[model samples]
Target: MPTPSAEAVLADSAGDAAFATTLAKGLVVLEAFEGAKLLGNMELSVRTGLPRPTVARLTHTLAELGYLTYDPRVAKYAVGARALRMLHPLLAGMPFRQLARPLMQDLAYSVRGTVSIGLLDGSSMVYVETARSGDVGPHTPDIGMPIPVVRTAMGRAAASMLPEAEAARLERQLEAADGAMWSGYRDLYRDGLRQCAERQFCTCFGDYMPAIHAIAAPLFRLRDRCFAINCGIPAFRLQQGQLEHEIGPRVRALAESIRVLVARPESAEPGSRGAKTQTR
Candidate 1:
């Protein structure tokens, strides 16, 4: 199956009357708040490619709906408490977090590294759960932190799970959207995806963050949603060979174990896989 271009997808969606353009634009206005403490209409317009008037209306609507808070004095908007209230339930509702945290903690302690589980959020991977070893150092994981999808092992692992055509389409879209940033690392990214397809895991060696290396594997759950788990260690502590040959398979096995745990019947045990743990 050939992947459709972004333009085609947008066009198709726009043509559908039930697609709710206004609602989509309102969501876009809310999303523009990511990583930003506050934004004015002009900045929001530029970020979302909506006209100033349209952005004003959208912001007004969002503010009315309690998704955003506006300050007339500063002429800026911030994420409202209502948004956090909505997010709290979603995070607390996921039963898998309770099931997965202990396993992640064990992995982190055994490998003396940071272990995390994440799901794709737009073009970034957002950490949903994390555990860190005592010696994890500066690379501590924070839940809800976003990592670029094209640059991290976890993101690559998720991408590798997509159909070949879809992956290619995504690569094309990324290149078109950010050619300068994408061009320098295109070959490396594609190679990582290929390796992930073959080995069921992906590796990053000081690619996204200097002096940090990680290995990641994809996990699938109900509703066809995909997630990724990664183990990250300082570059000085783990060499590239060790990351690939030693930690790669362990992380892959853990991911498979998590997948089985999620997909299995209620009576099944998640630890049946006997995932190997590293001792330092």
Candidate 2:
């Protein structure tokens, strides 16, 4: 089935069946990681909305190609070092991280909290780098920590731009989550993402952890692909309107600079195989 708008466009261009199928499935696999936790073969079947057998075959093929690695002991898969090795030239060629670091440090100093650079992984956000303010708070996220995407400003910022169906599926996962462990997010839940598409950022108060607030803005690679930057502020120091009034703009600026650097032909790295990059 095609939308009226899509039908008109396809009629005009003449439908290319092979192009459509391959491109669509490739994108499906890519999106499966947008906010997911670790996706095993079965989990990926659910996330990608693909059949189990298809997911298994794709995973097997990707693993053989050095893009994904299967850990038999854990029965899990993560992006292989080969995938990581693929990123080196891209990140190394361009100085996006280097340029952004100074700005992150400056923002951390001004805000008296912590600043971080992250990218979206499957259904979670992974922190690639972090700069903290003298360890002002407990529960500080380490460089490689992964956080639930539906629960963090960084993850929301990235996911907010996705299609509505994707966002809703993530919400279901959030709602289904149980235990006192996540009691903290209930209060901070905003129900729906607002102002994210327009602002290209998301702000959350005490969603990931009690007494911790954060502001996150998306960075871009080309024009629309979302990457992100975020600032973490402890509740103890948060003045009422600071996140929207001050921190938002600063994070957005850092994001913009990063976006510019990442777009350079040499700077954009191929994404990882199993694990996705942190979105924040």
RMSD of 1: 6.2
- Residue lDDT tens for model 1, 1-280: 1223233344458678777777777877877777899999999999877899999998998899888999988999999988878767767756787788888888889888999988764456888889998987667778877777778888777666555455666677667657876887777777777776677678888788887899997665333344678999988887549999999999888876775666532222111111121111
Q: What range of 10 consecutive residues in model 2 has the weakest lDDT sum? A: 270-279
Which residue ranges in model 1 land beyond 4 Å of their true spot? 1-16, 71-73, 88-94, 134-140, 264-280
Task: Give candidate 2's whole-model lDDT.
Answer: 0.61
Q: Summing lDDT over every window of 10 consecutive residues in candidate 1, give the lowest-scoring window.
A: 271-280
Candidate 2, 1-280: lDDT as tens digits: 0011222233344476545653355335534554443568788877666688877877777778776678888776666566567656644543566777777788888888888866555455667667777765865766556677667887766655444554455555455444342354633333314545455466887777778888887554333244567889888897889887788877877776665555532123322211122222
- Give one clash count per candidate, in the order shown: 0, 15
- TM-scores, one per candidate: 0.79, 0.54
Model 2 stretches with alpha carbons more than 4 Å out: 1-95, 164-192, 221-226, 261-280
Per-residue error for 253 in candidate 2, Å, reads 2.4
Model 2 compared with the native: what TM-score?
0.54
lDDT of each: 0.73, 0.61
C-alpha displacement of 108 in model 1, angstroms?
A: 2.0
